[model samples]
Target: MFGRSKDSTAPADQAPALTEEPLGTVELPGGKGRPTPKRKTAEAANRRPLVPQDRKAAAKEARAAQRAERDRQYAAMQTGDEKYMPAKDKGPVRRYIRQYVDARWSLGELFLPVAIVMLLLNMLLTSVSPELAFLGLVVLYLFIIAMVVDVVIMWRRLRKKLAAKFGDAGQQRGLMMYAVTRVFQIRRARLPKPQVKHGDYPE
Candidate 1:
């Protein structure tokens, strides 16, 4: 028992060498030898510049969108939808101006088409007879004065109303011009088309 050994252990250096299996040259589907990039970088690399023809197509689409917007605005003006109205057509002041104009009858309302007719008539008269044309001119000037006076009267009343309502609102910049423009437009043809009828004044 003293001369014999019961068991024996292997030496550390002589133990089996552990070998890791080689990962068999893994390849990316389409990117041989390339590093994998972030999503945004990959997307940017795929984006193409717009050529002339592509630009034209984009412009056409833009124009179509603009036309659709214009049509919507026109429809809103016709129906008086305050939500989608143009700047000039929006606000309580403009609405009041419309009511003021629509509440009364004015010869100024017929000024546009009538002035065109008068101009043509004047031209015709001028070609036929100078004296008749001169007379026509005088009459035309008088009519223009009357229209001007009508607008002035309208403006005076509008100013008073605006002062009473808005109290010197800085937005009154184009209010007179707005009122004058509306006066030139026919009542039935006014945009945001007159919610009030004749004789609905002093409100």
Candidate 2:
């Protein structure tokens, strides 16, 4: 028949051929190349105990660490190392002040020992002689006044020198108190121990 070609017409009972293609996976750039970990698995891997299992051992280790730190700081203070110095003792100005104070002799340094001797004498004399005990008290008062006077004189001179050198920074707040406290402390006992000797003032 001239109605249609044999290839163009399908048999009534036969099925049509599939026209769709098979799907393939697409690879993305910077892929992890592995499956993502589950939440529980990730959490477990990251978890750490808040408290240490060995309490005593942990405490001991902490104390040892603290002691080592203290020793390091102490040595730094002794050697006048700025990096390890406490905030109050740090800086060039404080260093200069320390040197200036160290170079001079303050009445306050001897005040402690002298006061102790005076107290002992007053105690002993109180029972033996009232007049002498009174005299000891008077002497102690006079010594204290002398210490005050010496500190005032030192500060007046040091202030002028500091102004001439460091300008405004040399006269920073609390520096006078810092110098005063240093003058009272024994030469060997001062922290950031004296870098200069007698008559070796900072220029």
Candidate 3:
């Protein structure tokens, strides 16, 4: 029975050899030789030089042309025998006087509006009470007196300044007095005019 029994698996003594074959050579679109790179020539490396001499000459010519134009203008003026007067150079004193006058004028211009606004405010407050109304009236009167005093003071100061600047000419003084009186329109005695013509009036 033992001899007839199936043979138990016997271990193989030799292992199988692996057969490896090299892969087929890949064919590129072109030949296997590497492509040659393009080389730059000396002529290609050399660039044209941009000289700015022409541009500089053009600028110089422009300046000369402008000078010629100015000279021509002066020559034309001379040929025409035109009399040119330069603007007056104001001295410090004159500048100060002008500035002072302008400031005073500006103050005068603002005075009326400011006074009116104050009066309106006073009136608004007066509407609340009779005492306030009376007080407002008194304040308004005081304000008006102050304004008159200020104007008189300014006029006197201006007159003094003018006198200092220009010595008193009797005629000028008289004219100035007339002008002041006219400007203020204050009640005064009748004055005679240097030039007056009596003409017959048609009835």
User: Regarding TM-score, does 1 or 2 come out ahead?
Assistant: 2
- Return whichever of 1 and 3 wins on TM-score: 1
Q: Please give, for residues 1-203, the per-residue lDDT of candidate 2 as tens digits.
A: 56788766877657676767433333356775456678999999999999999999999999999998889888999888888777888888888899999999889778888999999999999999999999999999999999999999999999999999899999789999999998888788888888899888788
List model 3 lDDT by residue over 93-131, tens digit each: 333333343334323334455567767877788768768
Candidate 3 residue runs with Cα over 4 Å from true position: 1-98, 104-110, 169-203
Angstrom error at residue 37, model 3: 99
**What's model 3's TM-score?**
0.32
Give candidate 2's TM-score: 0.73
Q: Which residue pairs clash in candidate 1?
A: none
Q: Which 10-residue span in candidate 1 carries the lowest summed lDDT?
A: 1-10
Reference-based lDDT, residue 3, model 3: 67
The TM-score leader among the candidates is: 2
Best by lDDT: 2
After superposition of all CA atoms, the RMSD between model 3 and the true structure is 31.6
Number of the candidate with higher lDDT, 1 or 2: 2
| Tens digits of lDDT, candidate 1, 36-98 | 678999999998875665777889999999999888888888887888888878888888888
Clashing pairs in 2: none
